[model samples]
Target: MLRFENVSKVYDDGFQAVKSISFEIQQGEFLVLIGPSGSGKTTTMKMINRMEPHTSGTIYIDGKDNNTYNASELRRSIGYVIQQIGLFPHYTIEKNIAIVPQLKGWNPKEIKARVDELLELVGLNPEVFANRYPKELSGGQQQRIGIARALASNPDIILMDEPFSALDPITRDQLQGELITLHKKLNKTIVFVTHDMDEALKMGDRIAIMKDGKLLQLDTPEKLLHEPAHGFVEEFIGKHRIIQNPELMPVIDIMSETVVTSLPQRSPEKALALIRQRKITNLIVVDEENKLLGIVSAYDVIKQLNDIQTIDEVLLPAEPFLFDSATAKDAIIMMDESPYGMIPVVDERKKVVGLVTRGSLLSAMSSQWTDSEVAE
Candidate 1:
C-alpha cells in the first residue's frame, strides 16, 4: 500500500508540477490518475518511486517513509512501467524480464524460472520468446514484455504510466482486458496514469481527476459519472455520460419473471399447447433443472408437428442472453443487436430466472426519465 501526504513537487525555475495532493491507495486496488497534459498526474505517480522527488511533504510505502530507504532499493521493490517500454534493445526478452531478479542476487535457475513464469503470465510463450530480442516482437508484444519485466520480481505494487497508449485500438483493448485479469490474479496495488477517460473507467477501481497541478475529484467510476464535483469534472467526463446512468440499473429491476418455458423432452403437441395457451410466439426450452437449452416457436412446432414427435426436433437457436446481475445498458445493447424479441436472464448455472424484452427496457427508461424530470 502507498500513501501520499500533502505531496508537492517544484522545479528549480519555480514551476510547481504538483500541488499538495493527498491520497491513500489500498492493497489490491487499481487507482487511475487521469487528466489533461501537465495536470501533475504523472508527476504525482513518479514521486511514489522517487522518479520525481517531492520538493515538500512526505510519501509512505508500507507505513515507512519512502525517503528513508535508498532510492535504488525502494525502486527495485516497486514495479515501474512506462509508455515507451524502455526495454534494453540488446537484451533478450528473458534477460530484460530478469533484470530485477538478477540484481536481487537470484540464482540462475530461479531467475530462469521466474522469467518463464512471467512471460507465460503475460500471455507470451516463454520457449519461443525467451531468446528473442525486443526488435523481433511487435509493439504490443513489447509492451507485454515490459509488463513481464515489471512483474519479474513479484512486487506488491506496480506503477504504470500510459503503458498501453502507443498500441493500436484492438491491441490496446486486448492489453486493457489482460491488465484487469492480471490485476485480479496478482492482487497488486496498481497506480495507473492515462489521459483517456474510457480507459480510466474500464480499468480503474477508482479514478482521480486532476488539472493544473491540483486534484479535482477522486471517486468510483459510477459516482464520478453521475455526481461530478465540479464543471471541470463534468467536461472531462464528456460524451460517455450515459454510461453513468444505466450501469446502475440492474436487469432484475426491469425483467419479467413470468417467462413461458417448455421442457426439452416435451412433445411438440405439449409445447404447442403451452404456446397457444400463453399466446406467445416463442418459449424458452429448458432441461429438468430449468437450465437453458434452446428455444422453440409455435411456427416450428406446427411445421414439425407431423414430422417429429418432440420439441427438440423443432427447437430454434437461442439468442444471447443476459445474467441477472447485468445492467440495463447491457440488456439494451443485447436486444438491439439480436433478432430475438426477448432475452432470457440466467443465473450462475444458466438456469432461466427472468426475461428482459424491448418493452421492459422502454418502460425502465421512461420511468427513469420521468423521475429525473419530476426531480428537476
Candidate 2:
C-alpha cells in the first residue's frame, strides 16, 4: 500500500543520506530495510512519515501522495516504534497507551476500553499493568507497552526502527516471534528496519539490502540466499557461512524430487503395490494435477485392505508440509516435533514438488560438514 519513487535525501552539508531508491510495499506485507550504520535505511523510513523530508522524488501511501497529507495527520495514521521504547516515564501504562486515542478526541469511556483491550492484546494484564509506570516494567515489557501504544489507534501501517535491538537475545527472540504473530492477526503493512541479517530473514517477507545510501538488492529470503544479485550481494550474505551450516540451507537444496505418489481414486491394492515397488512404507495421495491430497500408509491400507476398495477410503490426512522456501533448520525442527517419518515439500501453490526424510537431512548435514572441513 506504500510506494517510493526515485526518493532521495540530501543534507544541507552536501551529504546524500539516501540515494534515489524506489520500491513498493504490498498491503499486509512485512518489508525489512537492512544496512550498516551509514547506509541510510533509517533515513528512508523517516521520509515516509515526513519525519525527514526527501530532497527529491515522491512517496505515496494508500494511493495518495504523502506530502499532500498534513504531517501530524500522516504520522498519527501510521504506528511507529523505535529501539529506545519511548514511553513517557511520568505516565502510567494505561495513560501511555491512551495518548493517541485521547488526541484523536475519543471519549473517556472509549479511551478506557481501548486501553484495557490493547493491554490484553499485547499480553499484559490490564488490572496488573494499567497503573504501573514505565520504570516498573522490564525492558521487554516496556517494549510491549510501546507496541501497544503504537497500535492504540489501529493504524493500517507500522514502522519499526530496530525496535528489539536493545533487548537481550532471548527477549529479542520472543519479541520477534510475538511481532510475527501480531502481524498475522492484524494484517498491517509493516516496514521494519534492522542491521541484523538473521532478524531480517526471520521477520521480513522481502528484504531490502542497502549500502552507501543506495539499494543493493531486494528479494525474498530464499532468493536472497540462493540467487544473490551480484558479488556484493553474495559476499554480504556470508556465503561461506551459509554453505557450512545445513540449517541455513533451503529445503529445496536437499529435498528428493523423486516423490512416490498414488492417485486418490486408485485402488488400495494398486496403491499398496506402488508402495512395495518403491520400497517405501507410505505413498502421498494426489489429485489429477498432482496437488497433494493426503497420505496413505501401507499399514493403513493393509488394515482396510479387505474392507476398503480405493485409497481414498483409507487415506490419512497429510502431516504438516514444508514450503520449498523454508530452511533446512525449519524442516529439522518440524520433523523433530512430530511423529511423521517424512514430510512432503510443496511449492507456492501447495503442489507437491519433493519429499524430505530424516535420511536426507543426515546426508545433507554430513556433506555440508565435510565440505566445510575440507575448505578449512
Candidate 3:
C-alpha cells in the first residue's frame, strides 16, 4: 500500500537521480525495481525508506505522507536489507536481530522469542547460532542474519537492495528462491532492487523498468516479457528471451482460446454428439455463468450414455488446472497429471478462459529449440 506521485530526486550538485516517477504498490505485492547502471532503480528503492530523500513530489506510505512520520520511526518501521550484509560483527546473532525490537522498547523476553522465531524463519538454528558472532557464519548465513535482523520488528514492508548480489552464484540462486518462498509465506509488501533481469523476472510479481531516471514501465513479469511498452524496454529484455525460455511465456499467450465447451446439464446424448461433431475426446463443462464445472470424456459419455441423465454425473474433477496468470512451465509440469492431457485456464473468478492442450505445449516448447537452431 505504497504510492509515489510524480516523485523526483535532485542532488545538491544538480544531477537528478529519479525523474518524476509515479507508481503504486499494492498490499502484499512483491514489486521489483530493475534497470541498468544509473537507471535510478536503487535510488527509487532508497527513497522509500528515505535513505535518500526526494527533492520534490510526494511519497505516500499507506495513504500518509512519509514525511509526516519521524524519520527514525519511519525507517525502523520498514525492514531494510542491503547487499553488504550489514550485521554488527561484534554483536551475537541474537543481539544483531534484537536491535530493532529493542529500539522499539520490546521487553527482553519478547525480544529473545522474536529473535529465535526470526532465526528459524530465515532457516537458521537459534540454539546453535544465537550466541555466535557474525564472523562465525558463512556469507549466506550472514545474509540470513541480515534478513532476520531486518524482520526483528515485524515490519509490514521490506526493502531489499540487491541483498543477494554479493553472494556466490549458487548461494545467490538459493537465497533468491528462499526469498520468494518467504514472501509467499509472510505476504509482506516487498520492494526489491536488482540489476539482473533474470532475477527480476524470476522473483518479481511485477517489475518496474527504469531508464535515465524515468519510470519506463511497471507491469507483471508476463506482461513485461510479452509486451514491452518501449523500444528500450524491448531491447533491455532481449527479444529472443521468450523464445529461448518457454517458461517465461505465460500460458494465456500460447493457449487455445477457442475451447470446446458444453453445459453440465446437457444430456449425455447431446454431450456425446457434441464431442463427436468436434472430433474431440473430452469436453469442458461449465455452468450458466461459464464458470468451470469439470470435463466429460467421450468414452465415459458413450459407456454411461444410457445410465446417466446429465453429463454432470460423469464429469471429472478439474484438477491440475492452470490460472490465466500461470506460465508455460506450470502447464508443462501439470500436463502429466491432467487426465485428458489438457488443462483448462481459468480467470480469478474460475471462469474458463482458455485451454492448454498437449499439442499446444509441445508447439511452444519446440519453438525454443527452433529459435536456437536459427540462431546457430
Reference-based lDDT, residue 261, model 2: 87
Candidate 1 ranges with C-alpha deviation above 4 Å: 239-320, 323-376
Question: For residues 1-376, what per-residue lDDT tens digits would candidate 3 score against the true structure?
Answer: 8999999999999999999989999999999999999999999999988989988999999999998889999999999999998899889999999999999999999999999999999878889999999999889889999998888899999999999898865456557767877897899999999988778876788999999999999998768767789998877876443443556888887788999999888998888777767667788989999999998876578768889999999999888799999998898789757656679999999999999875345444433434564686
Residue pairs with backbone atoms closer than 3 Å in model 2 (clashes): none
Tell me the tens digit of each residue's lDDT in model 2 across 1-376: 9999999999999999999999999999999999888999999999999999999999999899999999998898889999998899999999999988888889999999999998998888899999999999999899999999999999999999999999865457557767887898899999999988778877889999999889999998767876678677776766433333656788888788999987888888888778767777678898988888898876668668999879898787787789899988888788644334578999888899999874345444333434765587
Ranking by TM-score: 1, 2, 3
Return the lDDT, model 3, position 178. Answer: 70
Clashes of each: 0, 0, 0
- List TM-score per model, in order: 0.69, 0.69, 0.69
Residue 346's lDDT within candidate 3 is 99
Cα RMSDs of all predictions? 12.0, 13.6, 14.8
lDDT of 3 at 198: 72
